[model samples]
Target: MSGSRPAATATAAAPARPGGGMRPGGPGGPFGGMAGPPQKPLNFGPSAKRLVGRLAPERLGVMLVVVLTVVSVALNAIGPRLLGHGTDLIFQGIIGRQLPEGVTRDQAVENLRADGQNTFADMITGMSVMPGQGIDFGALQSVLLGVLALYVGASLFMWLQAYLLNDIVQRTVFRLRSDVEDKIHRLPLKYFDVNARGDVLSRVTNDIDNVSQSLQQTLSQLLNSLLTVVGVLAMMLWISPLLALIALATIPLSLIITTLVAKRSQQQFVAQWAHTGALNGQIEEAYTGHALVKVFGRQREVEQSFGAKNDELFQASFGAQFVSGLIMPAMFFLGNLNYVAIAVVGGLRVASGTMTLGEVQAFVQYTRQFTQPLTQVASMANVLQSGVASAERVFELLDEPEQVPDSTDPATLDRQPRGRVEFEHVSFSYDPDQPLIEDLSLVAEPGRTVAIVGPTGAGKTTLVNLIMRFYELQGGRITIDGRDIAELSRDELRSNIGMVLQDTWLFGGTIRENLAYGDPTASEAQIRAAAEATYVDRFVHSLPGGYDTVIDEEGDNISAGEKQLLTIARAFLADPAILILDEATSSVDTRTEVLVQHAMAALRSDRTSFVIAHRLSTIRDADLILVMRDGAIVEQGSHTELLERRGAYFDLYNSQFALPAVEE
Candidate 1:
């Protein structure tokens, strides 16, 4: 986001349209005038890797999570095996030969050893059973208790992992948001000029939110699921390699299906978010300009346009969700097929005495565990892809080109500035092929008014932008107090100048807060003095809350003229050596304009002032008047001097006084 505003030369070749081609009064213009261009899909692998790199600062927490996940998965994997051992003990006790009543346990064990049933006798002895009893209920109870402990421990570790991961993910999101905020201040104004306000806001708010949510919900689950799959596969192989191979056969099929679905779903997810941003842009534009829509009878048109965008969002979201939704069920079906194959093959192995019945049960359990994580991973594909897409958007914003670098060794004003401004042979163009302000030269000594009068698109605003260093000059230099502006830091240069634009901007704050914005350290006496000078104190006193009145975001609590006066008061409070008034009085009533002019005259008495006005009558007494046409100074002189010459300024001044004749 470059800081410089594009020059008028770039817009000259464009077709002439109202509101600069913004669809101001129709359905197509709902998204703050014009819909932004389509977005391209982001690369998933690189984006995901970049997102992971952002977590590098939390390495300790991530390592802890990895350890906990491995421990938990190991415990879970051991549970079924332990249960199977308990089952084997119970089966042995049930099938073991019965002994004579009251036979000594040692004698029964010796008899069983003689009968080739020594293992069962040993089991009976371990349980303290007298062999008269059939099953070793005591030993079975101990094995069950061990299995319960494993499960409980696994649950506890999983809980701890979730807690730690949440902390890390939240902290990472905090850093990302902070970086975005800082980047916003550094971005050039040109970025904003070409981008939608709501779209940029979407990246800052919606995209970041998506990234946070997905990381919180999916990151830990993804890790745990993958670990579980690996652990289960290892356990299965330990039980029986053949069964393990059969179970593993389903993996490639699942991967093939998941990859295809994920590819299609990711594309849809990207589109879904893009349309969502567009809809948000539309809502912001419609709501911000609600009054204009109603006054222009464009309410129906706006609604129709909004509905179209809303429908697009619906389709894209539905497509993404529906495609990703197929993953779990498909994995489940494959899992069930694998389970059947394992059960049949393992039953044969059990019959052939190659594996015990207890081991077969454990192997089947391991197979289920293996498929479960795959299913879970498949289920999370949607979230992961959406998160990656969102991350791509956020990284794209952070990657925008910043403002031009400041000079390494900057120059400063040698003494207090006298407001002497000079534009020496300054040449510039938004595009290299078409020059706008070519070889322009001007000088305004201290305490003089330079009034610039021009037709629309005559580069009046561009000239002021150049003076303020909002845009760098393509050639030559601008100097203030004989110091080149390019050599001065933007902050230092702008601090010495004050501007009150035609569009008054006031944040959502008390009137007093807005007045004190230019100089926060201003005393109450100074604040009141500035307000009184601009005649804003009259209205301030009239309001029920006085200066403390809370203005809304749009500052609609006050009339346009009152808002203008408050801005004037703000500029006056700054007391800069140079001031810019861009049609500052154009929106005020005649009485209010007269008062403001009086205040402005006093303010300009000791400062270099540049006034751009459409109404020529107000600038009659300007120290020097410049008449501009086609991006050039056609005539420049004092009011009387220009009128006597009867050139462009004469024709322009005379046209305003011309009256309509009565029609026959």
Candidate 2:
């Protein structure tokens, strides 16, 4: 099968003629039946900005998180310095005990003060008065307790930050999902015509899921990691500017590597998600048409197609993961090198008396802390890229064009319409370069049955789309009861017309509920009356639940003909001024069709009805028969009158009976 196999099969199975059946480029059209080519990766700059903008409503919360993160990191950075102070106090006490007996306490203090170490001596002196005494255990205990208190405070702030950020992320995702749902309803039908159902679903389900997960997991970690890096670097500089410079040397190289790897990996991430969506689309299409695939014995073809898409997704996913995986290990090696350099340099500084042993140990700890955040950032690379890619897909969908705006001063039907409809010189084309319907004019007076007949691809269903305002006409005016349809709201206009399509759609509900869909306020007696008129009450009564029988999704619990009858009954219940029966009896048995014809005749006695059917035998009693060819009405008149005229209608009528072709 070709890539367009689904489209061709749908077209052959149920062709949409002018105003009668499904249109070619309407919902579930050939163009949208299958997934198209993969979309290119979106620009990261714009997508990121838009995502940030979506969180504008929670700016105050975000600001509080940032403040808490900063404070938490600052406390964590100061803890090491405080521990170093305890180490210094112990070293001073040990050395003071070893001081020569002849050296006085004042001399020792003055000597240390001259060496620019007055702060250390003063702290130790306050705890220890005797010069030859051992270390001051009390001072050591005090410094250790202070460090513990600082750590506890830091943990509290971190917890608060996490809590606030989580709320922000969840609320943002909620708003985003709501916007997508609203946008789906507002978008024009043409958007669906060119987009696959599964692909659109992927954006709503998988893509949004990715975005939400990434934000929830990555946002807090990202903020904490960044603040930790900055705080560690600042403390390192405060201890010794020279050692801080040495630690900073590895940063430029690590960043260059991270940037190169991230750039390559981002593209793969985008491709991976796109292929995932395509695979989902294929799965949805295949499963929805499983019976058809088996009937045609094309299971192998379907399997091969699925395998191809699956493989593509796997390759893209692997490439993205492998490239991003390189970042952590590479940064780890760089971090180790920085640690070694800082240890050696700090040892040399301690020996030269430029730094204390405690200070050297603290500086080394800070260097380790600095590299840890970089590793964390590297670990988050995959999540961040995936999230941005998903956000791009969602935003693209949200940006789709909606239906044409309603008129500012719209017209309304002054009273209940008498079921008169007119098409005045209407012109339209799905593709502007290929004109379909041109300068067509027609009128259906109240209580008229107008039958439209045409061959395949003759724009039969397109007329119904135009009449329902599913597609705007290029040039023309369609009026109901002398008022232009364009001037009336679509909801009001559609509510006044009832349609029974070739494909019967019944939701998963009780039979009564399905019947009441056309008129929710319909009484139970009225519902039974409508069902009885269309012969639906017979099968419905035979079921165990009768009118309360449950129908599964797709209404597969009932036979196709029974489903069709139910839809016809629904139309009867609606009782609109104008009624459309597009191949309504196609699935029913001959006997059932005859019964339905009788019911329809009575229903049409007081309404304008348009019947589209391929079976010439069924529409012989139509008051007006329109023979359409190449989008234009070639002949139209009463069934007998058209037969006598022997025009386009005669040829179509005779051809159906397998009679000799008659010249128009």
Candidate 3:
């Protein structure tokens, strides 16, 4: 028996992937994948900006981190200069101890210059040396202590900055998750119908985790490295502009490497995640329908699909990781080049006495600091690219068009309406090009059991969907008690209606909890009464826990009949004015079906109910049985009346209930 899911979902031309849904850091492949129309380009700039904007709520925290980092970087920048002074102190002290007594630094310099020791004279020219004084431990100790203090302050501020940055990144990611969750609820059912569930799930769980983890890994380091570069470069320029310029010469080369590698890596990362989603979708579909796959002997095809998807993931991940990985090593190589140039230039300057040994030492330190941060930023290219790709996926989901907002001042549906439902020239189509229902008008009188009988895709469920307002109508209106359903909020409208589909869904909870889901305010006696009415109490009383018996996720403990009974009981507890039953007894044995039918009769007492049944026997006693043919009511009457008319209903009845030909 086909359940009409395809036609019910109403998906027409959305480009949904074949299979679906984690990490692809690395294996073996070329450094790229198909980055064509299927995989849209990652909107790095906008996504990154939006990610940054998530920190708006924590602006104060961000400012604190920035301030703390600035202080740390400033202190770190001055540390080497202060350390250079300490070196100067030691050098001056040692030189003064060896010099003649009563001779001043200028006098020593003048004497050295007279002797043409010009470079040596220049080396100690600015040095505070005494001609005859020994190593002055007091002044040396003071300079050493001052350098130590600067370093300690720098470390303290850096630690504080790191501590605060973690908070900002986490909170920002938290808000992103919240936004994503809220966005999911607002999206239309068509969105889910058009996309694979696993893909959407990956966007929520995997993509979001990727975004969070990436931010945690890169945010602090990126901020610190970038600031460190600026701060360190400023110090390098102040110390020796020529050496700083030499160090900077490697920038263009580093940029070239990062840009080239990133271009290839970005595409691969996108493909990697896309493949991850595709793989997940396949896994979800296969696992959920595993029994059907085995019954149909399609296990091999499913396995091959999984294998292909996994291999694609491996290819993209390997490329994304391997290609992006090249940045760090390349950057380090340029840094080494920069490091060598700085050391050589500083040594020459020191030897020429144009710069002191201590000054050259500090300048060399500054060069390493500057190059190191650049290398760090370059190394982060892979992580940044992967993260931005994930963000793009998440943003795309958030940007999906949601259902129109509920009316601000919606009309209210009574707890117990008069129960007259009317479709005035209602027209709707799953796809506009292929209309399913035309200008069809029907009135379901109060307390009537309107049986909608049809073949699969004859819009049997579609009619029910219309009554429930699951999809908006393209023309005309549906009204209950003379009030348009569109004028009421969905929650308000749905609260007065109850539905029990063919497939029963029971969460992990006690029987009592499941019953209470129908109406939270139900009393113990009322719950038991409803359960007894649906015969759920008959089975539950035999179980050890009675109402307290916990249902597993799959509800394996309950028989199919028992599950149906519980659903009916749950619906009974709801006590809705209108009930919609979608062939609830279609799969049960005759004995169970009889019991279910009785319980359904009780549930439908004095209520307007729509029963979508494939079995013609079930709707025989209906007040009005509408025989539907491709979304139109071809005939409408009671079973006896339709049989007399010999119309579509008569044909359907004869097909299902007509006796077989007599044997020869």
Candidate 4:
């Protein structure tokens, strides 16, 4: 139960692996068997950018959102500048009240815009200048109204832009989730063996959440900050090029610090995600094994395991958040230093009579404005990085190669199948070096029963997997009625075959609903007939609601024997031309076994059938018995003929029947 996983191999033809260290399985084999792989340190970069590219199709909406964000930030930055203008106007009014300064009101307004200098500079420099103009109440009221209007407009635009930004992000995430689901279904079964289900779930749930949070909250803010920073810098230069040059010195330093911090934080966040997935998987495993834990009285041990995983998650999360949290404070500290520099330099200029008091005031206001955006951007760095990490995980899933692709020119199923099966020199293996079936061949004529008996791992299950086309044959081919299974449409081939697995899966629903799943077109009468054939009718009628009795999740509410009988009834409803019973009666008791045997007898009447069984008693009456060992047939004959040979089949049968069962 370690969090580490097997090293995933890269396929040049397949999609790229998500960022991580690679440590393939050791010399033993690639599958890793019981032991998991070594932990790989996760990275976040190229994969994240791939997600951005995936969102490119919606670029227009994203661009529109960016534009609105810039407008919002620009308006916000202009506020202080507008205030500076108002202050100059008030100061000019006071100067006008003094001895004539040779300035008209229009010229004063124009001068404030052009030079940000007022005639009052001489008075402040030891020349007793008198007031020029009295306070104009009407003008002051108009200025107040203008300020209110500008603030209101900016607020409205900020709200609108933020709304659009969130909308665009939500739409993109919705599509991303759907695409991931589709890709997961397309992935081969082999992929699942190497990857953790909990990890995949985390990517879809928590990672997607990160992306959404960045979009809704941080995305617009980041853009606004950038625009503010740039605009403020421009105005600062206009006010005092010397001070602006001094303030600009901090920009590169801040950028370098932010970049390094963001990169480190991103890597930590990726680890956090990995641990989160591990934690989720541990919880699922603990809960699933709760019965075993309680039976063994190991509740404390379970608790300890969970605590350890939770602590790992906590440590990783704290580090990531801590580093990300430093960015804002650092940015603000630099901003404050720049502010002090501007204030001191501007004061010197005013003292030397080189700059007017109004000009100095304007420069200080612009300098503060410029630093504001940098602070905002720095604060949102965590959200942006977290989103990028989540995006990478999601995109990786979507990029997995499809294991089963449609044929280049699929053949149409134009007629009903005759149910002839032939396995020609077919060989396969879960592990490439260990062939499960080696150049083995067999044929099942229409309406015949072909029973396959073998010890565990003799490739009995693997053989069935091929017939169902679950795994492609490594060599040779399987044909149905002279048509190669590969050439035939998967749907066409599978539609003709009905399967009853050893471990029957039952969805949460009424018995009738479960039966209907096999053939939705079946009538109630037909359903009852199928049930009766499988001896399921006896159990159904015993229930208070008969077919209406609800089966709990996984059919845990019912007995195993009853569940198997219901599955058989389901196959009957499908009325497939071919049937595969894989250990179909292994779980039933003696009495139930007899009833199930009757059902099997009826089922075998007019269809091609393949039976894989551990018990020799079930196949004693089979049309043909094939004994397989180590991927090849060791014996093939009728039950008596094989037993007479006293070979592998005889030894297998004698070993089982040799033991006498005690009465319950």
Report, for every candidate in turn, its global Cα lDDT versus the true structure.
0.83, 0.83, 0.79, 0.73
Give lDDT tens digits, candidate 2, residues 1-664. 0111111111112233332333332333221234444556558888978987999999999999999999999999999998878877787677778654566777767777888986655543443335676678898999999999999999999999998998999999999999999899778666776677778899999999999998987889888999998999889999999999999999999999999999889889889888888888778777777787798898888898888888889999999999989999999999999999999988776655577777878887888789888889998988988899999999989998888867888888755788788888788776665677777788888888888897876666777788888888888899988999999988878888899988888999999999999999999999999999999998998999998899998787899999999999999899898898888999999999999999999999879888988888889988877777677776777888888987877778777787566999
Clashes of each: 4, 9, 12, 9
User: Per-residue CA lDDT of candidate 1, range 1-664, in tens?
Assistant: 0001122222233122112235332334543344643456568899999999999999999999999999999999999999888877776566443566667777877887889985555555543334455677898899999999999999999999999999999999999999999999888755675666667788899999999999997999899989998898888888889999999999999999999999889988888888777777788888888888898998888888888888888999999899999998999999999999999998777655467767888998999889998998999999999999889889999999998767889888744689899877787765566657776677888999999997776778778888887778888899998999999988888889999988788999999999999899999999999999999998999999999999999888899899999898999999889999988888788898888888888889989999999988778878988887656677788899899999999988888887868999
Arrange candidates, best TM-score first.
Answer: 3, 1, 2, 4
TM-score of each: 0.90, 0.88, 0.91, 0.84
- Writing each residue's lDDT as its tens digit, candidate 3 over 1-664 gives 0111111222232211111011111111111121222466576778889877877899999899988888988888888887787777777778787767887788888888898988778777656677887677787788788878988998999889888888888878888899998898888665765566667788899998998888888888888888988998888888888988898899998889888888878888888888887776667767766766788898887788778778888988998999999999998888887878888888888767677778888887887888888888878888888888888888889889887778999999766687788888787876767777777788888788989896777778777778887778999899988999999888888888888888788999999999999999999999999998887888898999999999997788888778877887888899988889888776577876777677777678789988999887777767888877766777777778889999888788889878999999
Candidate rank order under lDDT = 1, 2, 3, 4
- Superior by lDDT: candidate 1 or candidate 2: 1
Q: In model 2, what is the error at residue 191, expressed in angstroms?
A: 1.6
lDDT of model number 4? 0.73
Instruction: Give the range where candidate 4 is weakest over 10 consecutive residues by summed lDDT.
Output: 1-10
The 10 consecutive residues of candidate 2 with the worst lDDT sum are 1-10
lDDT of 4 by residue, 242-327 (tens): 98898889989989989889877877777777778776656655564467678888788778867877787788789889998998
